[model samples]
Target: MAYMSGNPSNVSFVGAFLNTLGDRLFSAFNVAVEANGRMARVEALQALSDEQLAAKGLRREDIARHVFSDIFDV
Candidate 1:
């Protein structure tokens, strides 16, 4: 029934709270990077001409669908 700040057995509520906040921030950062990458893909696809798009079996309207195909059934 003893508590010490430096003791490994004693975990502070503040420390746990900060760790949870850090985890959420890191997760949000990762999601942002992923979204930016997807945006880059969209831009790259948009730069392609109709002929180029057809070569890949995609149309200009299908860019977003192609980019997020793995995540959505659309």
Candidate 2:
């Protein structure tokens, strides 16, 4: 009689489960870091006075546009 080897189905299920879990965790982490960085930028800009903003050739009205523009634009 031939002996049965490990179950390939179970192996595939475990691999898929781990891959999905890792993807979710990584996505959550990326979102959190992006939010934190955006908040930091807002805080830094808020801390600047009108004169300081002017010296940098920026205005308060331009803050959002400046922060959210594409990386290639910057």
Candidate 3:
């Protein structure tokens, strides 16, 4: 008669699953932070007086567009 031993470790996929989850969570956090920062900039610009805005070469109507100028051409 021969005796057989089963596999010792069973949770083989757990590490990979945790790593992927961590990466996704980190990416989401970064996106939220970036959007928050941009919105803050937009709000700051909106609070400025027309003269103050013109001093910075930005217009009230173009607040969002100006804040995102680096990412957009408008």
Candidate 4:
């Protein structure tokens, strides 16, 4: 008679599932944080006058694009 052990396989499956879940949760968190940061940046830039913005080398029209360029690859 032969006995088969299933403990190792079960543990491996649980570990893989947990790892994937953790990765997805982390990715979602990062996306939320990035969006919040981008919105804040846009608002702050919008509060600046044209002269002040130009002093910082930024244009009002490009605020959103500038803030989100990292994610958009633009």
Best by lDDT: 1
Residue 42, model 2, lDDT: 71
- What global local distance difference test value does model 3 have? 0.87
CA lDDT of every candidate:
0.92, 0.85, 0.87, 0.89
Q: What is the C-alpha RMSD of each candidate to the true structure, in Å?
A: 3.9, 3.7, 4.8, 3.5
Error of 3 at 26 (Å): 0.5
Q: Write the per-residue lDDT of candidate 1 for residues 1-74, one digit (tens) a residue.
A: 96565755445676888899999999999989999999999999999999999999999999999999987898
| Order of the predicted models by TM-score, top scorer first | 1, 4, 3, 2
Location of the lowest summed lDDT over 10 successive residues in candidate 4:
65-74
Clashing pairs in 4: none
Tell me the TM-score of each prediction against the true structure.
0.77, 0.68, 0.71, 0.73
For model 2, residues 1-74, the per-residue Cα lDDT tens digits are 98768898988999999999999999999989987897789779878998998998889888766776754264
Worst 10 residues of 2 by lDDT: 65-74
lDDT of 3 by residue, 1-74 (tens): 97656543544476678889999999999989999999999998999999999999888999998778888886
Candidate 2: clashing residue pairs, number: 0
Model 2, residue pairs in steric clash: none
Model 3: residues with Cα > 4 Å off, grouped in runs: 1-12, 72-74
Displacement of the residue 63 alpha carbon in candidate 3, Å: 1.4
Q: Tell me the spans in candidate 2 whose CA falls farther than 4 Å from its real position.
A: 1-7, 71-74
Which lDDT value does model 4 have at 25?
Answer: 100
